[model samples]
Target: MRLVTQQRALALTDRTSSRLASLQTLRSQIEHSGNLSPAAFKNQAEILLAFFPEIESIEWAPKIKSGSLDSFERRLQQTQAKTTQLTLSDSESSGIAFHLPIEYQHRHKHLPLQHPPGFDLIREAQWRDAIRSAIDRNMITSTRRYLAFAEDHPTDLIRLFLPVFQADTSQNQLRGLLSLELNVKRFIEQATQSNLAQAVPFEVYDNEDHNKIPLYHWPPAEIFSGLDSPLEHKTVVLPFADHEWTLVNVATPAFIQKYQNRLPIWLFVASLLCTIAVYVIVRITQSLAERLHEESNDRCWQLEQSNKALSNKMIEKGTFENALRESQDRLHDFIRISDDYFWELDTNHHFTYVSKQIVQFTGFPPTAMIGSSFLDMLHEEDSNSFRQALEKAIPKKRKIAIELRCKGHHNHWRWEKINVRPMFSTEGHCIGFRGISQDITDTKDELELLPETEPLLANESYGSAQQAINSVADQITSDRRFAQKLENFIHRHKATLDKTREAFFREALPEVAHELAALHEDAAEIGADKISELAGELKESHYKQAHREEQERLIEQLESHLEPMMDNINQSLHRQNPGSAGQKQA
Candidate 1:
């Protein structure tokens, strides 16, 4: 009997503890919705009903100001809900600063409560006090048992109050309140339905104030007399959200009678031992079967894990390959836009690959340059020297560099410098060479433009050299400026065509064409006939080619034509400084 009583007590404690913990969840539902309107409260109430069916009804009684009372009434009218029997009288509301009403309610089917839309709660002093306390304490508070008009008769009910406030409002400023109206008889019936509570009678009440009254009783019969005796029951205090409710559980008369009706205590102990022995024997047999089943499951689990690992590895490999391909594409794009071209040579020193940039640099397609020997493209005078350097460097797998002249598609010899490293296999056998080649003609011209002089400190020789170089640079800058002005003029007319196409052809085109014609005549007078010829081509193409295409074609031809004139000027500087040229040639 004592063991049975202990087991029931422990079970009741666990159930009560779980119920207390759920109070936070209940309070959170109210707090999370922010300011509750009818629709919002109804939605929350439906959620509570689904989660906790023991709840008879849920209510939201948000605080309303008397000043906003008319606005609040209009809002209620818009919802068109059923009205309550009484409205707040003007006299009653005069000093009432705030009015909390049942704005929303969701009632259970079995225990329905008709909470009309504007049922002001201020009339109920106990409810008013509980709400005020909850707001003051900034926590949940409960009212004593009260009679509710739910079933057309006075039904005993207790309400739990949780105050609401605007999230940004200070704690002392209460915005509204939420109330849960619990049917006392239904609540007790539900609590008593638990496995342990059915075997015992329990009563729950506030510990600090006996006058505050018990909230619920497990058995309806225990409501008045079952909690009267202290010697016959055990008590537990349920600490929940700033309030403590005392739980007193006592064995029922029927429970004690059933225990007494059992066989002698000694016989009961012997029977229990016999039953435990039989249970152990059955458990041994069950363990063997379970072991066999687990071994089969283990093999299947291993196969599944292996398959998943293989699938994951394949996914990782594919992702890595995709990333590598994207990086290669970006690298190729960089090479194409640059003034340099990448090249690769086989073991025989024959070109296996040349980048697309070769087209822009040498006026020769990359396809035409592939499979050609690197030595064949070099000027005859430098080929042997370059070949010797490669032969010495390849054997040691070292990087090599060489500057030589290559004939462009236009039959012009331009200087190019190649920087290369040998490619090797894992076994250390030389596979080929990979390198970048860049146009160095401009750099070579600048080097030739230097004055003929030996290295000197702050002396007259250094000053003279510096002045001479500056003079040549000024001439070069002047020539570049003229070329830039001509290009800008052509581009400006092309842009004008988009805005005034007919006017561009009639006025702008002829004016630019005549200017080029005059410039051509002036260039011939100056003995720069190459520049003269380029100007003549630009003037002639204005009538024969499309305006846009001709603009681009003329610009390219003019640039190419201007390069030779600049090169000639650089050569003239080199001739004036023979020692500088001689040093470069050596």
Candidate 2:
């Protein structure tokens, strides 16, 4: 009977082994097929490993004699068949299938059929339908493998339950019931380094045909190893119809309590000494740890102080940067207001900081002006002097002034005076230079206003002669109002002459006055018409006339408009720079 039970255990193991091999095949195929990611395959592989450790705890029938068979029979029952199946997921509600019989389920099969293409899903592609059918068949095949073992053995129960408890397309209820979890709490509770144990699960399949059978477990732990010593055991029982079969759990003995030989008095004393040494070591370690903790805290404090100092330095640097920016902005505003430009030059004579006023000065951006020498804007004749001043400034570290007419950019001829002064670092070492250029065109214009040098002396004598004639005419005007006396005086002188006593023919003056008034009106009208006509011609000919012709016309107009002004100016000059007053003083 024992031999037969051993054979039965081997058979159950073979069935499970075959199923595991087939699962491996499925995993390999899924991997090489390139349909799943490496991570996904690894996750699925881990799930399979989770299922594997359960197999180690499986129990087989114990030793039995000819009479033991009857004892076992009395304990169990014959022909009490254990029926089990696997349920697989599909496009429709999955079905449960058996591989061999209802009594054993250690062997599982592949997947089963998918539902007919989702009514609408079919019309789209026949290929998808075929793929669905293939996957479904694989699942159904997996289901059958578990059924074979369940049909034969009563002990192989997980194969029967897990398929349904964790069936494909399972609801939450099945997942909770068939969780298949082992309560490792026992291993944790009654545990010591000397006594190690692991909680294991047992499942029972009650077959209707009560055939007494054995089952196999692999990769046995120390408790399960019959060769290992000092075994402790626990039993779990489930009642069948008219019989109850038991499952045995085993463990290792406590290593510390299991004494193999007697110890000498000296050895016992040495063991105690070792224990005291360990306690001393522990105390020293604790003291060292406390000291290390204190040192770490002190280091943290020092680091915090240094960090604060660094942060303050950063803030101070930021403030100084802002102040420098404000100063630069103010300097730029001053240059702009004065129609001036400034720049800095390194010893290599490249502009380091070109001011924005350069745009107004040269019609080019400051960026364009940088990297150019100060001589770049100088007139050809003044370049030598500008270079000389730059060289002189470098040695003396003094301000050097240069005057030059910059070439007209955008038709603007600006008279600029460059003032270059050497710059130095705080150590009084030559760093570079700063130079400001001012537009001095107005100064030049003021210089040109020396009226005493305008060559008016050549016209002075003619002006004096004309003034003499004008004085003589003024004297005649005062004496010219003598018409009333002139007529009588002329008559008396003629009468005194007594020669031509004939009546002086006195013609009527009335007709003559009216004719003279009519002549004056005609002359005024002619003059007014001529002035209007000339003004129209001048307006039409504007800009089209030759420059010389325009100038001539302007001169003629100026003579006409400024004759009175010239006379007034001459009178003022006569008062201020008066020749007669000087002559009288002489």
Leading candidate by lDDT: 1
Off by over 4 Å in 1: 1-17, 25-53, 58-73, 81-113, 147-155, 164-178, 190-404, 408-410, 419-586
Shift in Å, residue 404, candidate 1: 4.4
lDDT of 2 at 466: 52
Q: After superposition, how far is residue 497 of candidate 1 from its true place, in Å?
A: 62
- Residue by residue across 1-586, what tens digits does model 1's lDDT show? 3432333334334433443334444454445445446675566467556644556566555555556787766776676655222223232444322333444444534554345565556656766677667877877777776776655787776677776666555555555555666665665454334333134556667565567456666555546433466446776666544556666766556545765454255334534543443344335434533443464356557867998999999999999999999999999789868889899999888989999888866787889888988888788998898778877766545577788898776778889988998898988788888999889999999888878685434336325445545554555456756434433433333232132233232334555665567657756654557767877876676577556656555555665555544444445445455675445435
Per-residue CA lDDT of model 2 for 207-263, tens digit only, reads 322342222221123224322224543344433212233333333333223322322
Per-residue lDDT, model 2, residue 52, is 44
Segments in model 2 whose C-alpha atoms lie over 4 Å from true places: 1-293, 299-303, 306-321, 324-338, 344-376, 397-399, 408-415, 422-433, 444-586
RMSD values, in order shown: 24.1, 33.4
Lowest lDDT block of 10, candidate 2: 496-505
